[model samples]
Target: MQNEINIPIILASVRKIGDAFLKQYKQNTIPQSMDELLKQLEDIDVLCLTSLKKDLTATFFHMPWHIGDEFDTESQKESTIKGDYWLCDAMDGAIQYLQHIPGWTINLAFIRDGKPLFSVIYDPLATEMFWAKEGAGAYMNGKPLMVSKKTDLGVMLSVFEYGHQDKSTNQLNKEIGMTVTRLLDNFGIVRNYGPHGLQLAYVGAGRIDLFIQEDIDTYNWIAGMLIAKESGAEILNADGIPWQWGSESLLVARKSITEKYLEIKSLK
Candidate 1:
């Protein structure tokens, strides 16, 4: 199945979209107010979907598809349907983009039976493309990618996101705060670099040692998780169980330090 995928064509399509998106991104001024920011975000989503939905559908007409906007609260409550489909986030870092930050990206994944079969993440500003196939390994700009071999929790760089604020509960916020506190106390550097996909791609590239998040959405995880996994990172739930599509929390870490990270996560 992996061999049958036309990687070059897929990459070209995503790159074309990224290039166009980046051009518009550069033309816009940094949003000066909350209202302006929200407006820009809506505009960007429309621009992304307008191009991406049309191109992807025409490019791979047979596959089913889902975009980030479609997975709202009610839809998320339903179980994931079993089948092959294209899962994409047209603007993975909408906030960063509106703020004129450089951490956004276009994320795409091909999932079969709820497992990623092929994935690609494009950072238009950086012109870096990260991709992976089930057994073919992960890559950035055609070079093979691998997770960090760092074993010392004290010296590792870790990243995380608190998930959507609109849906966050007091309990979820508290857990995120506690986890961030714990990580900051132990790791050399802890920060959030905005886009979830890029953060996971960074782990796959050994740019960061760990990534953890609570209540991650399917679109936020699938592609990047595949890249991290192919680069030899461990994908597990907060409790150290193997991660599945609907897992509430996510932990992607380098192999040598995964157990230690899990231990820290279990701390009272």
Candidate 2:
């Protein structure tokens, strides 16, 4: 028999009551609180999927990647970027909203292999829950989600994070921009929400069609990719390649939808 590597996982329960910073929920509900739903995720990450994830931790601020900064190994050396504890305190900082409610965050964690094994983006403000597992699938608050059927270059809607707008014209930007411009040449809409968890969730839920990013860091992909897969979206590189951690990433929807979008948009 071949040798197998068993991954040990650890996760703690984090409760968020009342209005916290969640992206957007599909529908409005009474109480409008995610405390109970979030509690469920605490177990989903540790008990159900722990074998694939390990060394997990979450905080408001984690990696310090700027617009022009490369997500390659070099980015890790920037000491100026703060650590976990600093971010934890910052999340509950006085000037920030934590001063009043004592709970608000961008849920982040890592698995044993240094990849973003699993994660959730809870924007209580918008009431959106973005969660994922590494390979199995991704979801938002138990409901199945997916990208829009609108793939036409003219009619597609796009999602992006912050750094892409401010960074230099890097290859990541080039590839994405080319894709967006091609789509926009027909009238596609590109939108940026400043968070990957939410961005990925939106795509999976079919709220928007396409979401692209240069930084496929573990934190962003772990939960996001799973949700996309579960929601029936396609995950791969833009040039018809597979998507893997620690590399450039592109998320496309189903072939029928994409083909339809392409035909309607009419890109040569």
Best by TM-score: 1
Residues 141-208, candidate 2, lDDT per residue (tens digit)? 55656567663556667665423233454566665566566555544677765545555666788876
Q: Candidate 1 overall Cα lDDT vs. reference?
A: 0.81
How displaced is residue 133 in candidate 1, in Å?
Answer: 0.9
Off by over 4 Å in 2: 1-105, 109-117, 134-137, 151-154, 161-176, 214-218, 257-268
Q: Identify the runs in model 1 with alpha carbons over 4 angstroms from their true place.
A: 1-4, 29-39, 70-74, 77-79, 165-170
lDDT of 2 at 98: 21
TM-score of each: 0.90, 0.54
lDDT of 1 at 245: 65
Cα lDDT computed for each candidate against the true fold: 0.81, 0.45
Measured by lDDT, the strongest candidate is 1
Scored by lDDT, model 2 comes in at 0.45
lDDT of 1 by residue, 13-76 (tens): 8898889888777568888898988788777767766776676666577787777653464454
